[model samples]
Target chain A: MTTLATRRQAAPGGSTTSRPARSGASSVGRPGFAWALPATIFFALFALVPLAAVAVLSFTSWSGLGDPEFVGFENWETLIADPVMLKSLWLSLLFIVLGVVTQTPLSILLGVWAAGNQRNRAILSAIYFIPLLLSSAAISVLWRALLDPNFGIPGQLSWLFGDGNLLGTQSGAIGVLIFVGMWQFTPFHTLIYQGAAKGIPTVLYQAAAIDGAGTMRQFFAITLPQLRNTAITSIILMVVGGLTTFETVLILTNGGPGTDTTITAFYMYQEAFQSFDFGVGSAIALVLVVVATLISLVVVKVSGYDKMNSSLEGL
Target chain B: MKTRPNYAAGIGSFVWLLIVAIPLYVMISGTFQTREEFGDNGPLSFPSSFTLQNYADAITSGFGRYFLNTVVVTVGVVAIVLLLVPPLSYAIVRSRSRGASFVFRFFLLGLAIPAQAVIVPVFYLINAVGLYDNLLGIILPTAAFALPICTLILSGTMRDITGELYEAMAMDGASPARAFFRLVLPLSKGGISTIAVFSALQAWNGFLFPLILTQSESTRVVTLGLFNFQTQYGINIPGLLAAVTLSMVPVLLVYLFARRALVQGLMGAGGK
Candidate 1:
């Protein structure tokens, strides 16, 4: 019976929706090819071709200005050993972890509190969402004012409290940067969880409450589990959003105080576009692709987000 | 589920608000003070003397031009994405073949490949195509990337549209074109507005693409225009703050009015 259950769950139907393109199958009655031809070829040439070219360029040595020469594994080996690249990898991880730790729980609590309430909750959602509504560039600028040692809020606070300051020092700097990133992102997660929590039938809570469940028990029993799928997807999206961060860190510190807070993407910026090391930049881009793809695969498998998304898409 | 409004829960939220509101209040208030007052005054202190001088400086420093340019670029991009995405999504859903699915996956891949990584090559391509340092340069690529997710959302909305609607219309010789025009466009208003809001936000706030691809006062976007507000000496803090406030207003207004659609749009993306 167990073996039968395993086989039944392992049914060929699992890949049916995905396999059409996954297997590279081309079939007849293929709709109007002429209809989609322009868009497909445009995306292929512009999007796919560049990505593929960057992948190929990862293996070669190009002056970024002149010709190219094939060099096998050189960029990969350099990437693996490069101190700056490794530091960036660490910083990126630190940033993402900090974001998840600080924002996720807070947003979850707020989202739960905010859901299904008429007056205060809607106002609070609107208020929290204000940050998300503003441009990051604007936020970075706004916070930079608040962080300025000579003229910012923290400086005034420190002077008022005699605690030194919050921007020039390394820990203070990293803290503020993380806080800003968290502040901007927490609302997004809150927004998602609120949607997820609201979609749960109100009767589930009423049903649970009637069974003598306290508020905390009701939260743990109903909201968290119901929001788990959204939590997973938002966490993954947060990681992606964190990894893609450029303007925030760029404006905040320009990677700062001798690359102390530098990230791989930022490092790639300095190496390739800033310094015109195109080959090296391409190599880093390929590394990002690999790392991003790995995280994507792991997240998809673990959370089944793609499956969830596909199902959502199929709706 | 049915408890009275918890005063305790309400307080919990107000504390969080206090944390977020401090910086926002301070920033806006700081803009009202002179450099001396800003440097020394507590963030919560009422302005000793209200000053609009900084806002004046910001307005004079080409806020008008930047605002107009942003409007033009955002409007152009929004118009194009709306025009292109609906028809393209309709084709994909209407195709009913393996090709539609293939093309569908093709657009999905764009989401995975970080647009940042493509900047260098995209720069070269844009320059090669002679769009460099121009408004059209940024508009083109922004529209391209916007296509993917917009297409994704619209396609999801499109596929759910029953074939019978098309069939019923088709009996009157409402050709595929006419069906899309009369039926699909009308029915998909929610999805299309969602697409518009999403694209408008992206285009309005878009920085990296415009920063790299466009140059000079002629085409600089609001996000990049704020850079000119800064100097090697020190940032024009008040001017920049006013600039930030100005740039944020339009989109903030939109979000305020259509937040349901905006949040609903994001949830729909995740749900899909």
Candidate 2:
């Protein structure tokens, strides 16, 4: 990489670097490194420093106002013994599972069905895309009203839904949380899959058709195979989104109906801000980060993320 | 390519659309009704009388203040992101050095670290820096969190610019900054616009930063304010929904106009 940079510097025709490669130009005047400094500094001050602080803070018994006591794994021990933490962690995982199970297949189906971008499909796609346009807070607010027992949509449609209220029951609230997530994001995955589907050369499917394969066969044989990489990408996105999602759940139920909807992030917020237990909060935060990183790394390795772009060569 | 109706797909699409649309209708329509109408007629019912009273109530009751705070933070964050990301992404994509790659990787690491993980320290950090209760507290961290993805998208877009364009600018004796403004900036409009809208949306909708970093009513952004507003005015559902609808306007308008770019950008970002 260093050689590439020096060689590129020697190539007088290329001016990609922020510093022009002019004859007799001083090496100290290269602006490429300087140009990137602001973003790097901003990132260091905010992301890197805060990350390290959190890691360090997790090991200490510190409130926001005083000197931290180096407790050393006591927070982690407390976390293990805490039932609420365990429950919140389990619920967070369940929410992610529910999201992946429901959203991935549904998005692929929707993507395949809408891939052609027909006129009517375009109109329907616009309608389907509406949810993606709104803020999660707005959606949570809207759903909160709609889930109201007396006057909202679910209540109005009680004849069909059996008078059950969402936000009030443990199981129902979790279900609705997952449902809302799928509702808001399925369009996103569908759009990604649609773009991927379009990238597949039509000739493959057409040739299959000429060989007397029906639409179903052509789909399984041609479309599904081609969609594999995109499907993996979609799963990575879906899982990460599902696991990290807290805003809608936060606003919709605030992890209420007795903490049924409280994911780890929500629990962390409650601990740190509401309860002012920064040590436990920081520990939860580290745990969440570690778990999320492990899960995402596994997903990436399984999906062959490095090979995804290259595999599109067949298209 | 005949315009033949595929009834199954059409019906499926329509069903999904309805699932997505009904709540939106409920929210907007619910905002237009009086609390009496809302309670009496059920939220799904069309309003018998359209009223601006809810809007009046929302604006009068702290929603307006929160809206302005949100606008300030969103504008500040977006402006910083756009100014910094373009040049940084340009540098990363242009300079093929080990140091540049390390910087790029460092930025990407931000994506994995959830804001929740850093919120503990971030809260204290803001307090330590004396930015607690300041909008800058929210702006700095929010912009920082937004950098990784924005840089990723911008660098991807920048790398796609043909090498010939850079060569031509070099031959013209244009300095790198001059070429960036004269050649790269003009050519990277799509990517720039994408990240601009992306960053703006993030800042507008961000809940965690404003919730954690800022404490005073003066520093509150809309999302946090909306939560508090709902709790305080829990009984006045219409007024709450009205505030919700009002907050949706700015972003809704942005989405309507930039739907194409937004969709392309999101897909492009995710596809990578």
Candidate 3:
């Protein structure tokens, strides 16, 4: 503990003293790397270490029993040929696209609407936030009961949903998943946009009003453009979230009627836990990581999120 | 404000509200009806009879145990996050060391690593460490995964503490730890509570960790319990719906009490 204190003291002191020509007071009470070490090591042990292990495990065969035996590319080769694996990747992409397409405009409108300080808007926003309270597992279970072909809403509204095999057919199952995803997540994205909308300079809106821009014209001209960064952040979240969605599928359809909704993440869980094909699961997991990483990199590049470091530079 | 109301947005949000409310209405209303009544009346119908039997059955069928276990995990996760993230975020915001910045970037990259992608190895590692089927197994990994986002949120909060505050603390000859305790901690209450609520929700709502890491009835969390409850009581829709409602009660209570903080905390997830 003495060494820790001195090192903490000396590091900042040394840096400040070396920069004697400049003001050093701000650095005097600054923390040291020791403060970050514990969480870094803990996060690495659990997240990063296993992340690396997953990549290696993808090249080996194991079943949660014995030591993983190296099989060098066989898992990859088989995954390449597996139709379900290929289809699952497509399903994951489709989910992302559909989630973005459906959620973005709806949330943007709702968020802007909710950003109003009016009493009714506040009450409605609170009610809208209800779905966000339930866990994905609970929401899935709730939807399953609500969409039960025999006695659910679909049954009562048979004119709209004949025979109500929503979970039986491929398109119907996908529709349920997308609709549920929107129901569960739009409020969250709406919250993000609401916060961003609140941040958009009121002066801009006033100026737009002065220019005789109607609400529609002002929203198109001011609100959407100002929300660009938030849109990127929200979309990236949706992408990553869509890629890793598992519990909803598990509880709702169990990758359904015949792996029709088996996105890669769910497929990986099934392969690893259900089928006990750890190697195959790891391979699918690696694909998920690579896909997520690629998407993140693209977003960072496009949105300059990494460049947000500039804000921390002097501090 | 506009002089006139916007009917398009008004109607759109109202429509969306119906979409959001119907399932919630169904779930909540369904729990009050008997099985025969529900089957006869259909999900959309108002219940002819209201009974607390579904909730009683849910509790009697081990939801209490699941609730206790979930509380344990949520508390464990929130504790770990509170203990670790503040200091890490503090270092990231205040430390000048290269290692600190590198660690910050490391966690920034960690934001991309989803828990599902690493579950296979995590399972192996947990089993190897004899934490499988244990609550700690769920707690450790869940807290670990929460670190990236929590660090991001707290660090963002910490950075908002202007340089003048630190310089003033330095003028008082305060040590780093003293400054952290006296100034940074007090100033960062918003971030701290946000992370606490965020991690607690993650742990409370966690399904994959508990589903994969723990198998026994003794370690069952609410989400896993509800999942299993569904399969075991598939035909008993009211009981299943009641279980789902039971799982949401704690979060709903928190929501009622602290809606603003909860909403802000969730918005923090978007890095706002």
Candidate 4:
């Protein structure tokens, strides 16, 4: 606490008292606040103000063209009753569940494999990470072409899955979306887990091996517990990513064979931009924000995100 | 002390490689052949007649305009970020005042708010300000989103610079601003480049803002342009693949050069 206190007083350009021992002790008065002002103001205009605007607009009835009439809870009431909106929220949750279920184990296994000091680690890691380099738009287009019924991979190997494209049906489209989502993001989780695993001292593993602990035993006893925070981070990241998924749904299925894969973000985009129901759309967007914020707050509590920030703050 | 053959690990690697390579090969090979050849021969076959016609068509058919728009937006956002974030990071590092700390915390809090959540008001707000369908509209918000992580990385690296350096510079009668340029910026080159590549990548790959914010062809970026092109030329599979390949080539080159720095930066954020 004393160190923090003195550090506050020791800030370079703001103080007048003579503290020449500290590095920033110039005290020549250039106001560090001025340095941060432009970026801070930019953040205010773009992020802070727009967020507040969204909150306010959620209570109003407006088309994108005219004066917004104040309508108390009307938009909210409609959102609750709208089956499509409800379905969108449910589908978003399903995407998250599917993403976690399919991606987590594969990422963990890949992380463990990559953590080993193997001879071909560089090439192997790069190969696994190729999806990270491409845009979701590109990936969607590539997959869509590869799944085309007449000319795609499935069509070429016709006996395996029959003649129809996987993306042409409702359940198949959702399944493909989940599969592609996992394909793109699993490498990111692998990278995170590998990084966390690399930080573990190798001596612990070596000692455990000498004590006759097998690879699986060492992994269960040491690796999982050490990666708990990273796991939490990955979960939070995936949940947000899943909720905000737009490009894949947009390009691959367009929320189709008829609204089967429409997630909340895409639905909100449709309500506002395509349909011009700005009021209802704003309400939906606000609801999404509220849900995301609640989840993030829980994440901060459970995952020590604030504590991590504090420790990083000392730097 | 004896070791197993590890056939399982090798097989797993092979399976994962096949998973990544299949789609990549499909896309790349499609770019090299004519549409009829691509369709009749099937996607998995080797392009028997490799030609650059698909690339030529992709370029001549307004792909250059979208590519240039993406470059402008990406460069604009990265430039604004590099200019503003470093100074703010310097401020946060040099000052431990409550306001500074609060501001730093505020910036960190911004990470939790994905732009998707705010796109509703962001849309109207941009419209209100008459930036609708404009490239600057996208650049401003993208730069705002980029600031938090960039500041975090820069300030984290800046703090590693010794206090003695600043103290010595102070004794030499240098102003804080002079010390900033002469001392801090020079030392934090690694952090600066890391954020540069990271921000550029984010801006390049951005889809949502470009999708909603800019509706006109003049303001269209590559990500949105690819979607429109695919829709408009649904039958022209080879040309579509060529555009996708062109859109990714720049990022692939960047990744080859800065793979280590990017991994380290993302690792730093993850490790936290």
Candidate that scores best on DockQ: 3
Sort by lDDT, best first.
Answer: 3, 4, 2, 1
Q: Rate the local accuracy (lDDT) of all candidates.
A: 0.75, 0.80, 0.89, 0.82
- Residue range with the least summed lDDT across 10 consecutive positions in model 1 chain A: A22-31
Off by over 4 Å in 3: A1-28, A302-315
- Candidate 4 ranges with C-alpha deviation above 4 Å: A1-31, A303-315, B262-268
- Between candidates 2 and 3, the DockQ winner: 3
lDDT of 3 at A67: 98
Model-by-model DockQ, in order: 0.36, 0.53, 0.62, 0.54
lDDT of 3: 0.89
Q: On residues B40-158, what C-alpha lDDT tens digit does candidate 1 reach at each position?
A: 56556778978888778777778788888888888888887887788778878876667777888778777788877777677767877888888888887777777788888888787
**Tens digits of lDDT, candidate 4, B42-140:** 888998998899999988888899999999999999999999998898888886455677789889778767787788788888888999899999998
Top candidate by lDDT: 3
- Pairs with backbone N, CA or C atoms under 3 Å apart (clashes), candidate 2: none
lDDT of 1 at B158: 77
Better of 1 and 3 by DockQ: 3
Ranked by DockQ from best down, the candidates are 3, 4, 2, 1
lDDT of 1 at B35: 62
Query: What proportion of true contacts does candidate 4 retain?
Result: 0.57
- Tens-digit lDDT track for model 2 on B1-272? 22345677667777877788777787889888999999889887888999999999988888888988999998999999998999898788776456777888787777787777888888888888899989999999999998988888888778788865675566566777887888778989988888888888888888888878878888878888778886777778898889888888886686778777767645545755
